[model samples]
Target chain A: MRARIVDKNDILKIVDILRKDHEVIAPFQGRGRDSFFDVVTDANRDQVKMHLHNPYYPPKRYVLPHIEKLFDIDQAKMDVKAAYVEPKRAIFGIRSCDVHGIYHLDRFYLGRDYKDPYYERLRRGLFLVNVVCTDKELDIDNGCFCMCANTGPASTEHFDLQLMDLGDVYMAVAGSPKGEALFADPIFKRGDDSHVQRRRSILNEVRKHFKLAVNWYSAAVRYITTGQVPEELWAQVGNRCLECGACTYLCPACTCFTVADRKVDGKVVERVRLWDSCALSGFTRMAGGHNPRRAVHDRRNRRFFRKLAHYFVQRELSMACVGCGRCIDVCHGDIGMPSVVEIIRRGCAGKENDSTIIKR
Target chain B: MTQPSSNDKNIYLPKVAILDRVQDEIQEVKTFFWHFENPADQEEFKKFRPGQFAQVSIFSQGEFPASLPPSPTEKETFFTVRTVGSVTSGLHQLKAGDKFAVRGPYGNGFPMEQYYGRNLVFVAGGIGLIPLRSCIIYALANRDRYKKIQVFYGSRSPRELMYTQNLREWEKIEGFEFYTTVDRGDADWKGNVGVVGSLFKKPDVKVPVENTTAFVCGPPIMFRFVIKDLKDMGFHDRDIVSTLERYMKCGVGKCGHCCIGMAYVCTDGPVFTYEQIKKLGEDI
Candidate 1:
């Protein structure tokens, strides 16, 4: 089926239609430069930022929330019940990189050997309305590297309806059957070849807006896999790391959690899963006090190795990093993925020059 | 051996088990015998191997991974716990008939099939002997399938030693050499006085370095020293096996807390060979 062109007013009409059945979530400006996903009610309809800045936090919380209650235990009856809830909802104005992030999370959570029933329940009921990035200032910014990650400016697949801006009009393409159903109404019309050309030009323009170029990701992979990157460089990076855990918490693909039990009363107990970070000292601690990765540098080394090592990467079936570069902004030590790659690149080059000198 | 979530029920939803019996193993350590409240669940839960642990839940407190000290071959399933922190101390306060939730027989247990025909050497220190006791009992139960078995145990003092009753029985049993030692003996103590590695020096204890699989579980310092001694006496890393303990939330691989490098300790192992341990690239 051909892509369709829709006006801003018509896009709002689709949101109104979706709101009738599903809880529609759209990006809205949240204090200062920060933007977040919020439910679209009639009062807040005009506040939705159609042309966007990528939200400070990715939409992963919708699927794998911060505090998920796994089960409840009744002490008196000796019974346990699963606390699972699945809500039908649709998210509008999601950027391309975040869509890729969701796809990555799906591959890890559902596509893996064991499908998380909770994540699956929420994911299956959800609808996505992805918007292509066209505004350099609002959509593309200094901290984005989705071009290098091969996941952005526009997504090739995995969306319900992909909305693209054509200056005054928008080109809407159906990426799934659910997306195609929106076209049954007259709000969408068949898009021409001229619309396709316009999207390509807009994408090309946003690619140039990226502040820092990241040509080292794949190269760093080889050095990381071969175990040739010197320990000295990692130690230096470790020294700089404050272990604030902002990086992993901000990174869209970082999915570590810890389960905790709380006494609801004398009769019942609740078990909750909270977001966990590997950078913390106690992440690998055992009961009677034995910890692997106790050293700050060892833990620091672990994070990079897990993300870039060939075996781990192969297991995840995709590089853990989608290179959204959100880590760059959250990191206090300035030891985010892009910076780590640059340090590794420098170390690899230095080692090569040292080898050349020794041979001579 | 890599079971990435094989359970049919919600993996985190635990079965309520009643604490049937409790015994003080030492000053700080206690062994509690528990049975599933649902008789069918008890039958199902009894199918775990040695070295696997269960997540014990005391309602008011949290859950902790306690080593199943009793082997599957044993009639009762028990956990030998040391009161190290809140959850463990909470378990210590719980009496017989008190209810708690338990799920798992988690982590890859000791590879019993691989050690079937080899000479077995078990070394443990302090309350670290808890998990090792499961293997010793299992190996002795299936005696014909294995060769010579030697157990070397150590503790800070005579008072701190664990599982004295089991040690007494093994000492009298045929085809088994059991040696005990205390780092610093008391007035009534009359045993070898030194670390666990020192036991290997006794005339009766001939720890065959070759053609033997050594299983060591202890405090980090003891583990390091014992590993070094084994290396000096010539035991390949692959031939050495040990159960690792890591801070775990979900016994399933989903929680990244137990992760070290690429392997999740909760899934890939709480049981691993020394060769695998080195490759993990962490400070175990």
Candidate 2:
């Protein structure tokens, strides 16, 4: 809870300090309107943008990679060796929703009875630098619902360091001792209560910028938990789904995966796990061809039920949806969280009989 | 941050197990007897309860979940796998002295001690007898704790019956009632020539409906018909139990592949009562 101020131009100096001990990754503008997170080396250090659209792909992959090796097997000796990679890394300019996404992953992977050693290893080395969203033109979008999801426009906790824009100066707050150590650098100047007031007023103004603000999130959760949403509504939603699995892949909180073993040079075998989607038909199909969730509508029902249901939310102590809106942006069928919630809200209001809302 | 030491236990890592023997139970299905290379691992695995399962790794092929067919009280550990996929087919090709790896004793196994002094009925069709074999042997080992035990097993034909050696032994247990049937009987077949459910209505047979629990496992069609028969006989939904199968990668609860409704079949159950199974809202 210590605050400091740095000049707008010297913000990269914080990245420089972090890079001395860790490989700092930050957001950079790609093609028009696209942004991505990459390593901030000397060549790309100057290109690190302080403000841009949140990347389509989540930063959770940094902690839990898309494909991770679980074991290396020596075929002849029948020896099995566990594999892991733990590089000291810092992700700079992460959004608040993505920060909460990592917290959800922590609850599911480490807080459970059996801890996932692979996720535990990578997460131990991660440093989060959360950037509060202030710029309406670049940061806020129509798809964002972080205000309703209660994760943004500024996070209250769960970050190592948090940065806020204040015109000429960037006010930085340290949430951990590791982040407070960076305040000793010459680029940082001590700030008083007046700067904290500025941070509060700026956050209040930025919260109004989100266009898709609605408070039906809890109502949707209630309907899903109680199973009040009729089967017809799910069928209508499932009819529009293309099953491309982009929604689950781009989601920051989704953590399903499938494992496989492949031969290497005909001497060893490597067991690897790749990110999996429940939307795929093969995800639940057993070896003898019996699939429990064979219907497309049943698969569509699973994605939302896992997120908004009370049982899962209570089990993990956090809702799986962070309101990052990447699913809204990436979904080809227009059946993202907000759309699905709207469908449920309308369906519960007796509009389900109307063909306009439930077209069947 | 501290690096994990070599001695730290990794749940995903499998221990080496060497195949001691193999028995071809039926066509395309074989039971492999194996033990962990380390005595410590074998000692730990022996504590597994019936209805639990293990992940078997075939090195270059892949890993698959298999039911532990041997009871904790049995002399050996084995897996009865039918060649259904690439991983199982790779296991079928292995000979004696071949090396593989295994992890677990995972899932909530049947709570056998809770069913003490109650009559037990076991109904299985074809290879569905694999998981139930463990429970049957465990019950027979502690035979004084139960009142009565009845077993009814059926297959497509006389040639497709599993665990014939154990079936022959159980039929001669004097006080126990053992029945076998086949959908189609060959010339040498003479015991019964109907579905497994037909044994429930035979003139000489009487199935106890009071203070009795029925364990049913088989193909989905058989399960549906047998469940109706059990319900018609006034068996409560809570008294009918079965094990479910799903495509799984991690035998632990981390992977979401085996999740149904709000429960993970890996953790909450592979063994569930008919009442609990109905709440899962998914087809068997």
Model 2, A1-360: lDDT tens digits are 888999999999899999989989899999998999999999999999988999998999998899999988889887777888889999999999999999999999999878898898898989999999999999997799988888998888889999999889999989899888888998889888888888889888998889988958787898788677899999999998999899998899999999988877788889999999999999999998888888898999999999999999999888899999998888889999999999998888653345444553
TM-score of each: 0.93, 0.96
lDDT of each candidate versus the true structure? 0.83, 0.90
- By lDDT, the best candidate is 2
Per the 3 Å backbone cut-off, how many clashing residue pairs does candidate 1 have?
Answer: 2
Output the TM-score of candidate 1.
0.93
Q: What's the CA error at residue B81 for candidate 1, in Å? A: 0.2
The superposed Cα distance between candidate 1 and the true structure at residue B91, in angstroms, equals: 0.3
Per-residue lDDT of candidate 1, residues A1-360 (tens digit): 348999867778878888988999999998777889999999998888888677878887888888888778776776667787889989898887778778878887777555687788789988999888788878877878877777777888888998988888999989999889888989888778888898888878877888765658887887887677888888998998898887777777888888787888878888888888888888777666667666788778888887888887778776778767788888889898889988998888656546646786
Q: What is the Cα-based lDDT of residue B252 in candidate 2?
A: 85
Find the 10 residues in a row with the least total lDDT in model 2 chain A: A351-360
